[model samples]
Target: MDTLIFVLFLYVLLTIPVFVLLMLFAVLTRSARLRRAAEVVSLSACAALLVLTFERAFEKPLLWIVVVLLVAVLAFGVSTIVKAARERP
Candidate 1:
């Protein structure tokens, strides 16, 4: 279980950049659908990770790191939503 948590932690750490790149791609393409999809998927995945982290007993440091990542993902997701809402139809 510990090994699984550690692997998941590493996976999240690595995918942070991938998520950023995906958002960038959405922005570059000027596709609201793509942006919304990316935000939804990213936020869902991050929330799942957070839930998994909390479900198991883990070190404080690892929990803190996951919390921080969750916050970042939340912020990004909110910003994307607001931006999409503000754009002219």
Candidate 2:
């Protein structure tokens, strides 16, 4: 239970900056290091989410956490698309 809470906490807190950093990276130089970090964090979070969803341990309130995760994922996607559009000739 403690471990689950910790993971949820990490996801909630870290996701904010993760989205911001991803968007920030979209605007700034195409640094591979930042790109890799973003990919790892996002991927790890996604995998964790999948496992939690399947495990059936998270309670009702945790659904809100899932919503936040969805928003973060959307942010990442939108930022990537907008960045791509801005870079086009």
Candidate 3:
């Protein structure tokens, strides 16, 4: 399906920033836990992004639900990293 391929392409484009940020965060952070968290957050966000695209392609009314959930996840991940940074001596 051309639409599916297009959605996949768009998903890759959208996720590139998340991937770069995760890579940078993992490389810059000294804590093993932080690096592992980055991996988890990145993978989860990528999966969510893919789902969002699929939902969008089908014109699903529940697309907003996926968007909200993804935003919440990203916010949680960022907060966790910031909390760790602040607690470091």
- For each candidate in turn, the TM-score is 0.51, 0.47, 0.46
RMSD list, candidates in order = 4.8, 6.6, 6.9
**Top TM-score model:** 1
lDDT of 3 by residue, 1-89 (tens): 66766676676576677667767776887657656665665756556575655567467767776666767777777677678779888
Clashes of 1: 0
lDDT (Cα, 0-100) at 87 in candidate 3: 88
State which candidate, 1 or 2, has the greater TM-score. Answer: 1
lDDT of each: 0.72, 0.66, 0.67
Q: Model 3: residues >4 Å from true position, as ranges?
A: 1-37, 40-58
Count backbone clashes in candidate 2. 0
Q: Model 1: clashing residue pairs?
A: none
Clashing pairs in 3: none
Candidate 2, residues 35-80, lDDT tens digits: the string is 6567667655665665555355346666766657665775786577
1 or 2, which is superior by lDDT?
Answer: 1
Give lDDT tens digits, candidate 1, residues 1-89: 77877777776776677678778989899876777777776776676587666665255555777677777877787787888688857
